[model samples]
Target: MPRLNAVLETALYVADMPRARAFFEEALGLSPFTADHRFTAYTVGPSVLLLFLEGETTETVILPGQMGTIPPHDGSGRVHMAFAIDAADLAGWEQTLDAHGTSIEGRTHWPKGGESLYFRDPDGHLLELATPGVWPNY
Candidate 1:
């Protein structure tokens, strides 16, 4: 039997569709490979990042306020997603974010060996731009 092996897409919940679209399209240098009012999809390298708005059409959870406050919605709780980039590109990536006026949550350096910068999308879902060394054993 052939194995089911493709990682085609990953979807994220967002409070505002347009704002999410703008952040990915403008800030992250990703264009909407597909889009509509309910969902917008962007090309993130070999995979696609999709934004699904919260509402009747979709059952996405909008954290009430801030990190660690939202009650669990789908049984499994507390999740975060990250985008990995080349370690050498960190400074240039920071420049892109700064130029786009994206809000920076903070940056972290792993004593072992790695770096990451955290930020949120329009809907406040935590996102990180990380280096592979952050999880060297994985």
Candidate 2:
């Protein structure tokens, strides 16, 4: 059976696109590879981080036969996502977060010998910087 190799994209909804863009640009130091009024896509490692405006993901049928209706949706509440970092770079990440005046909500020392730094984005999305061993076979 065919299996998935990796996750190529992840999305987070934002009420204000400019604010979200600024946070991802200035705070996270991520430059958008592709962007428009509706959404921005940032390349993170081999994956893409998509910041989309809330309730804007409605269906746009480009072709009648090939494309089907895309339902509109909006995200609510806080969302969570984690970024894996080099074990040696954990301290650097902490320093970066500090430099940006981003509060570290919590830190975790996993039982399996991993470390994680937790914080929130401008949209109250829980973001994490974790060391390699945070997950098995990661």
Candidate 3:
């Protein structure tokens, strides 16, 4: 096997694109790197978080300059995405979420000494902010 470096992108399909975009922008303070009527992409640290309107990506998308084609993709139900944060930053993050009116839906104290704060986006996708030690590598 060659190797795997990192996850480049993650997508979440939403019933309302504007609402979803706003939630991420306001709650997480993420600004979109690129966007169009079909979708909006926010640079989440090194990776990208794409918010695609439900049913909009049912057909393959052809990129300009013959770069490549993105195959049709869609998702439903509650899905989860976790972001890594420092232990010292956890409290600030919770405060930020509260200021944005985003509630902390749940939390978990991992056996590895990590802590996670769980919540939902406008689309109801479960989002997590996890501190290091949550994983062996981290």
Candidate 4:
């Protein structure tokens, strides 16, 4: 059986590349490590946040014998993802989001003892800043 370790990257679809880039870079403080006409990738701790143009992502195709490409995926509707943060940093994160003019959609205290701040990105993808206890294992 193959075992999975950690999530090294996560992809989010956006309608506007420039707007998404600005939200992740200027607003969220994530530095873009690479970008092209259709996508931008930002390093988030050990993982990468990949933002791709909606239609472009759906049209991606990989040719095995030739040049490989990311498998085509749909980029419609609101998608959700969470980033883990230190428990003590929750307050600061809220302040940061406020300063960025991003409204908090909700806040939840998980039954497992974790806490989360829910918000949306420029493209309306639901994003969360959560604590380690959000899952069974951090």
lDDT of 1 by residue, 1-138 (tens): 989765777768777677778888889888777777777878777788877666524353464556434233321123467888889999998999989987778899987578899987767678899886788551
- Model 4 lDDT per residue over 29-100, tens place: 899888899889999988999988888866657658878786677667899999999999999989999999
Task: Please name the candidate that would achieve the greatest TM-score relative to the true structure.
Answer: 3
Runs of candidate 2 exceeding 4 Å displacement: 61-73
lDDT of 1 at 41: 79
lDDT of 4 at 46: 89
Q: Alpha carbon lDDT of residue 80, candidate 3?
A: 96
Candidates sorted by TM-score, descending order?
A: 3, 4, 2, 1
Clashing pairs in 2: none
What TM-score, computed on C-alpha atoms, does each candidate reach? 0.73, 0.89, 0.94, 0.89
| Higher-ranked by lDDT: 1 or 4 | 4
> By lDDT, who's the top model here?
3
TM-score of 2: 0.89
lDDT of 3 by residue, 26-92 (tens): 8898999899997999888889989888889999899899699989988888899999899999999
Looking at model 3, report the run of 10 residues with the lowest lDDT sum.
18-27
Q: Quote the lDDT for 15 in model 1.
A: 72
Pairwise TM-score winner, candidates 1 and 3? 3
C-alpha lDDT score of every prediction, in listed order = 0.74, 0.88, 0.91, 0.89
Cα RMSD to the true fold for all candidates: 9.2, 2.3, 1.1, 2.1
Q: Over the stretch 1-138, how does candidate 2's per-residue lDDT look in tens digits?
A: 999999998889998999999888987889999988878999999999999898777656254786766556567678999988889988888888899889999999987889999999988999999897788976
RMSD (CA, angstroms), candidate 3: 1.1
